[model samples]
Target: MDPGCHKLYHVHGFDSRQFLEHYLSDKADMVFGEESLKFPIENLTKVFTEGHIKGDVLIDLSLSSMVHHLYSACEFFNHIIVLKAQDRCILELKRWLNTRTGAFDWGHATKLHADIEGKCDQLQDKEEKVRSAVQHVMRCNLEQENMTDPIVLPPADCIISTWILGAISKDQDEYIRYLRKFSGLLKPGGHLIIIEDLDGTYYTVGNERHHYLTCDEDFLRKALVGEGFVINYCKVQKRTNMSDLVDYSSSIFIAAHREKSV
Candidate 1:
């Protein structure tokens, strides 16, 4: 398996199917149900089912929950493709998988596992920090993009991104440019799945602030349509969190190809 791909599995905690199931359910609740917003759970279920039947690639971008589901239900696809910004997320995932022997001392391994489990206990705890880490790394990647044309990693048949495009760049124009580059990474006719926090709000990690754009459903739908992606299904859900520091209103988008070109 590719090291990067393996790392994503490990960081997302795919040690067992039961764990993945619980994680997805909790994520669905936090982002959709709790905030009184609707999510495309059924659409996601359909995509997974189709991918399973056709043995196609599921390209997951930043959406750890869907990736977790796909990895747990291994029989659904030929292989998984994960696009992640942080090396630490990958490393943590690999540690969770325990793929390398002698990589960690027994005591250290025990502690690491406990830490991962504790973080996974709630969606907000895991998501806030993980996304912050991804954002920091993505900022680096965006800066690198200025020096050279963006590099397209291996392609996939179905692409899923959550909280990804809205966080592209601090500047709106730069964000659009970055997203266009991201769109170019997908193969023609491939699927695109997105979930984002709609309202402009802040999520804190140990007292640090991570700013977000006000990505309402209309703005995103219009943006994707303008980008030439057909709307297969779109749902705006309220994402609620128990924490006072975190924003509770968010939206989820699940879109597919409208034509054969990017």
Candidate 2:
């Protein structure tokens, strides 16, 4: 489900915060943070230095709003182009970016990221960093071969996609096709970071249910390699808690670099 597209806040006592507190990080103490958040941030910090940070990075920032993938990213990329699948998603992101009246509460996310970096108290600073780093917010169609279509954005130094692919693709073949289109937006040798659900078919947001494409590591590995990526890092976080609403066995984080053309 596109979080920005959902009517989450209106639902009274929405326990999404509590659910995330459990799912995204370890249930006990939450010391390490969630694998989905921790993996990509740590990897980005390690690979791309401040010198390479001035280039373009394209991302689906709507998902990152709650997940806070941009927490580490903003530390590097000077130009961030956020690709929104719908105008609603664009509006949702803008609300937070503009610091509007009722933007999605990211306090939990902001603090978590700071703690991960050992800067435990500067929540507002972290939020401002992300807000300032994102320079462009534009529309994209995941089903189309040309994701950005007429925009023709500068080829990105990196690209990050969250759970949107599973919602858009009906099956494995479509997943690969979508992946190829996303990867093509990156310059050769540019990095691609994906956070995917493993064996996940459905999840619930508020009271509504959403469908997802179930995929395994083998499928992901083949897709990346066939699409010309050499895997740099990969890992799976087995589901520790179960809820009737979401049916996912694990979360997998993959970081791969596109092979340079001769």
Clash counts for the predictions, in order: 5, 1
Candidate 2 accuracy as lDDT: 0.68
Find the 10 residues in a row with the least total lDDT in model 2: 5-14
Candidate 2 wrongly placed segments (more than 4 Å): 1-54, 61-67, 260-262
How far in Å is the alpha carbon of 189 misplaced in model 2?
A: 1.1
Best by lDDT: 2
Error of 1 at 124 (Å): 24
* lDDT, candidate 2, 1-262, per-residue tens: 3333432221211344443443454455543354555655664555544344335565543342343777788877777888866555567668889999976666766776676677887788889988888888887766567767777778888887777677566678878877888877888788888878888776665465556777898999999999888888787778764467667788777878888642
So what's the TM-score on candidate 1?
0.61
Task: Score each candidate by Cα lDDT.
Answer: 0.46, 0.68
The estimated TM-scores of all candidates read 0.61, 0.80
Q: lDDT tens string, model 1, 145-261? A: 431236435555665666655544454565566566667656676666676777655443333344445556776777777778887766665554555544636557566663645
Best by TM-score: 2
Q: Model 1: runs farther than 4 Å from truth?
A: 1-43, 50-55, 63-75, 99-152, 240-242, 258-262
